[model samples]
Target chain A: MTETNQAIQLNQVNYSITGELILKNITHSFPTGKITTLVGPSGAGKTTLFRLCNGLISRDSGEIFINGKSIDDYDPLVLRQTVGIALQSATMISGSIFDNLALPLTLKGEQLSEEDANKLLELVGLEKSLLYRNSKDLSGGQLQKVSIARTLVNEPSILLLDEITSSLDRVSQQDIEKLIKRINENYGTTIIWITHNLKQAYTIGDYTVVMMDGEVIESGPSDLLHNPKTNRTKKFVRGEIE
Target chain B: MNFLTLSLSLVFVFIPIVLSKVLKLELEKDTIIATVRSVVQLLAVGYVLKFVFDSENMIYILLMIILMIVAATHNARKKGTSIKGITWKLVVTFITIEVVTQTILLGFGIIPPTAQYLIPISGMMIGNSMVLSILFLNRFTAEIESNQDAIELILSLGGTPKQAIHTQLVNSIKASTIPTIESQKTIGLVQLPGMMSGQIIAGADPVQAVLFQLLILFLLLTTAVVSSALLGFLSYPSLFNERKQLLKKITTSTSDTEKS
Candidate 1:
């Protein structure tokens, strides 16, 4: 199969749980080297969509192509390493931060020297002193950062963030947003960020896709927030309805 | 004696009900059903054991050991559902422990291969090893399943699956062996172990019986630890495939209930 120019391409993707469609027929393409924010309310299937891309959940009917090849062609383990994900509820193993960060690389059979891990920690804005600390002892924000660092340890081509900063304070949120931007700009990593915060979406997303009831309502450049064609999009962007 | 029997029967019948009611447990029916089943099974086995003991046939003794193996297999399978090749694994465990303990006993001339000596000693060793196998397998399976991510994390970090689960396996073996160790410690102090008391009643000298009992306890403790650890290590590999993904198919039907 030939690779597509898009980082991730979904064609007629449909997912349901217990016969209720969580994500309806959806077709979209995420461009390479760009930050795309999937904005939706709760139950809008944002998380399910992430699962579909990662092959954690199978679609009832649809095809997902990662980097132009069918997702089925890649082993799930390999796919996970290539397309790293950070969950909203960051689950840390009961171990030190160094262990957590080294997990993906270890699982992928990649060599991770101490210096490499230390450098990755610094990239995620974590100090070398935090490496020995137990992951459970870290605050929510610090843990999220650790999760991000762990996901990036393999240096995946694409990164998926599922509401990673929704629980953070203003300072932590801004700090992570800056780190994310730097990662995208410096490493040229494709980013798919899911969030409910339209302000954050506008601030960080190069492209924005707004979804409701398992369907994409509108999608365009981030600047399209200034001139939304759909009334629902306008209402959502203006906070008139959630 | 009749009064004693009547009082004993009454206490046995009503004590369970009183305890269940006091504890506010909703398992009255289950408890009663299980108790009845246990009583019937033990009674049948008791008579069969008596016949076997009297016959003094080596074949009958061997048959009894086979039966013990089957029972142990059932118990081990029920506890470690994820274990594949369960029957063979359990048989290996049963045979290893039984052979080792019996050989040492007979080699030392402690129990002259008599049906009386063979049956009870074999029973004790088999029963203790069965319980240990169940404990070790159950704990090992549960720990691996619950801490799967941690295990995978370690594996991904260049640790082999065996290396990743080594600590958990050791912990499980230790957990299963502690009871036998404690029982050994309390022998002849807080409580008389069954083998020692039975030997004394069967016309053996008290001091000689004590020495023999200590030897049996040590043998049982060693067998239980080795067999349980071996079974646990052997069975755990079957839970995951060559690629290290957890196999979803479990052998035992009761596993779902235990997992929940």
Candidate 2:
């Protein structure tokens, strides 16, 4: 948890499944207390890299370190608890909203009280009255908010978002963006946002990294939108090309 | 025993198949193929059974029962390859049930080791056990794979792996055994059972055949429940490693393509 420890570190990571390389030998560090957005075109290995960090998928070679410790050193259960993730397809289980939000905590053997559940609901801009509703009945945007609240229930050190707002309307998308900014600013949670939208990335990201065909093409502060260093980055920002 | 009646019965086997096709659902081919295979295989066994009944050799009856158990085990193993050491597990389970049931029947002097008692009773038990094991194993494996994330999430939150998979495991066993229970309950009321009808056709008194069928059905209920429960409990541990992490390699799904 030191400044040099880095919230997440990928070192020469190369991942392949069945002879097809999905992620090349790419090295990067997600520094603590900052939001890093991984922007790339379709099939650019963004989700694969996120899964590797969360320990959902294994890497064929190289190592990933979180908080100065190699991924192999930590148990998978511990890694999941420390690094929470929300899938692009925000799925809610067959349960009430309270049960959905309290799932991580309940599994951890912490008895979930009504007050704590209400507080978590309020954090996501959801009213306390909605806690007892069926999770499947929630709107798309509401489900994503509940999913984020569930991810935060255990207070993970790093939160990995994989196009969480891609399926939402503009207003819902903005609501999620504001929520993400609040979570990062108030809780000091290291955020790794993966998206194809340049505008959203420019709005929320502190450090923006552009990936294309499994390689990092360019990376800099969010101000790079004003003066992009790479032609690919500029074209992508202007919607001239994918 | 007329050819016309037997031909008519063949048409009856198509009821479930035709219904499924008209509904335009999946599993139509599997159902048809399974039904056809069962008919052909059982017809061959029926011929062999006629010969065995005439000979009335105890060794022949015992061998036939053993063969049925072996076939049942093989079928169950094919469905649950994810459960490690499945061959041995199947053998242990079927053998335990066969020995226990055979002993109880023989002790009561129901029909001695004659073909009359051995073939039909063992056939009913073996067939029921096979169906039960297939249902239990398939459901168990599918449930585990589908709910893997939820299970892992629970484990990370402090639930033991056994505790995490408890609901799914129980649900699988319950689902597998419920049909047998339901059929047993509705036996003489809703439908005339196969064994009872067969017995009455072979010149046994109706009441006596009903009693025998009832006993066999009760034994089947016990055997199916016990075997399914045993299979689920014993096979579940093989899906996880010593450190309690799920082993992804142990999947019952045979296809190489990964499901999203």
Candidate 3:
């Protein structure tokens, strides 16, 4: 892809821990303003890649570019602000839901007015009344919504999701998927989502990237990935392999 | 007190050792070791204080204060070695606590600026601060381990290291200081503090001893708050890297690592 077409580009990315190659010789580009689903087996290094993109951890050997600029060019906190992430289980600070929603601005020594905070809650498909409620009082689904709204408070151009809906009920999972699509459409955000659910990956993502055994096996349009050309990809799609 | 009278005090230690032996509690060895160590250490400190007081030298006073700080830091930093540079952070905190408390005491003539006056008071402040530091570190590290995801969540959303660790840091500070605050509330009604009891036993006026004890209690209040805050602020930055990510659990603290 052309540099301008990519929101993030990784060149020969290599990462290891304790002599185990978690990610090896990876080169990929995530297209601008599009949702890319990263599907892989349990040990495929999807979370590690997300950590690298957000500058939470350094890669062993690689050059990563965001918006055609080196990730190293941006300050770490600034880079994180540009690329937000939500974990599978939402962990809230000890405060009201509004405080959690307003945290991004609060960290910057600014305040998130009630109206703006409520707008964020509404955007995430949660009621504004939850603003004054103790964040810990929410259910798994509500907490995940608050987590997404909190990430949106940063207004990141890129959002990395780490199996956020995997543990939720089917209804909550669908709700999250719809919310993610809405977020992509309304903000034009570049999203890199990781999922173990093959069907969900093939359907929800605009582009699908398949990974297995620490390597990208194939990538293409989601429709094409459903019936991939490569035998490895074909095997993965048919649930014949992890 | 005479050496014979001090030696007689060893009987009080025997009661615990005897009880442990009868109950098969297996605490006799530890109790004996603690008794021996305390007796030796206090006697050594007493003789050293006697010489320093007679010399009336400022350098000697400074050395004694430094010695106290070194001992306190060594004990306290063991609890927080997972915190990067915990040794130096502890040293700075003890020094700050000493300076702040002594400045108020001497600068206002609350206490005479003599080795006799300075060394013992510095010892009490540094000793209390060291205990407070240990409590804070224990609680703070536990908070970090349990709430690591919360800290990372905040960091992922553009929070700085300070912002990320703020909740754990504040909570730990409050937890550590609570013991001191609660004990102070029931000071004389519940228990006569050791210092006041000691002063009265030394033939000091009852009212005068209580006043001195109150002064020490007030100094401890400062020690509790200052030690926790200073150590908390200093230790937090080291927990995160320049990338603003929380570093792995501090490896140097074997006990904390094992607990986790």
Candidate 4:
């Protein structure tokens, strides 16, 4: 696919820490306005790859392009503004949920009005009343919703999620999944989600990429989970191996 | 100030030793070692100060200051083992504190340049800043370890490095400097500080001793803020790699034991 059609493109991307290779020459393109799920076992470098895409972390070698431009071509802060990321267990500063939601705008020297903050809260499946409540009083699920709402305040073109539902209960997980799908459909926002659950990847992913030991093992449509092309992918999908 | 008077002070150590033996606390060896070490170190410093005073040479003064900074950096770096290049970061901050404090003292002619005055004042400033450095390192490392996700969350949302660590930096600096500020608030009422008491015991005028001690206290306040701020700024970048990635090695295990 050409760069113009892809929201993010990686060509021979490599990353390492302390002389240990984490992502080895990864090359892939995440299509614009689609949900791409990255699935792998622990230590497979899926989270590291997300960081590299957002420029929160740099690749040791090769090229990563966002919107057809080299990642290095844009300032990291600017790149991050365009490609927002949310971690699984994020912390909120000691303040109200409104304060947390307004942080992105505040950092840019912009103000977020109460009406707008409440809008974002509703979009994330949280109540408008939660805005004035102290974030410290929030449960785990509510905090994650707040975090996701905070990330959306930037209006990023692409969003990267790192197992955001792993720490929540079943109801919270379903709520988050619905919210993410609605965002992608309503806004045409490109999303790259990292998940350990093969079922989740199959259920929500338009395209699924399987990774192992810092390499992309196979990448195909969500249907690939059932008819995996490789023995490793079959074992991974079948829960026979990590 | 005489040898006999100083020797009589051993009675204080003797009391602690006897109490430890009677209580079967087995702290006798530790107490004796501390007493002996303090005596030897102070006596050695006293002789060195005398020599530096008599020489009246600039190089010797500068060398003594450098040695103090080196020793201070070595001590403070222990608290921030997770930060890479921590020794040099501490050295930079300690040197900054030394230069700024000494420049003020000598430049404004607040006190004379003679070793008798310069040595003791520099000692107070360096000693206090060293303590502040250690406090900053401990708090900064702990805050970063605890708030790693928050910091990354900030960074991933277009916040700059300064913006990302700003809260941790402010908290660390505040935590490190609050004790100095609180003590300053209660300076005279809480207890007579050692310098003032020493001067009063040495037959100095009560009012003059209080004035000089006040100057030292003010200097310490400046050292507290400057050391905490400078160390906080200098040490945070080391917590990240060249790629701006927060290094995973910084997390201290829950069961990790520190030697000191």
TM-score: which candidate is best? Answer: 3
Candidate 1 residue-wise lDDT, A133-160, digit = tens: 9987899999999989888876788998
Write one digit per residue (lDDT tens) for candidate 4, span B84-173: 888888888877877888789879988888878877887788888889988888888888888877887777888777888999999999
lDDT, each prediction:
0.78, 0.80, 0.86, 0.85
Residue pairs in clash, model 1: A4-A68, A106-B156, A106-B157, A107-B156
Error of 2 at B231 (Å): 3.6
Off by over 4 Å in 1: A16-21, A57-61, A105-111, A213-217, A224-242, B1-39, B54-63, B69-122, B133-189, B215-260
lDDT of 2: 0.80
DockQ of 1: 0.13
Which pairs clash in the backbone of model 4?
none
True contacts kept of each: 0.04, 0.13, 0.57, 0.54
Docking class of 1: incorrect
**Model 2 lDDT per residue over B67-125, tens place:** 98898898889998877888888887787778878888888886677897778878777
Could you tell me which residue pairs clash in candidate 2? A107-B157, A108-B157
TM-scores of the candidates in the order shown:
0.76, 0.80, 0.93, 0.89
Q: In DockQ, how does model 4 score against the reference complex?
A: 0.40
Candidate order (TM-score)? 3, 4, 2, 1
- List the candidate 2 regions with Cα displacement exceeding 4 Å: A1-4, B1-63, B76-119, B137-171, B233-260
Candidate 2 similarity to native, TM-score = 0.80
Give Cα distance to truth, residue B16, candidate 3, Å: 1.7
RMSD of 1: 5.5
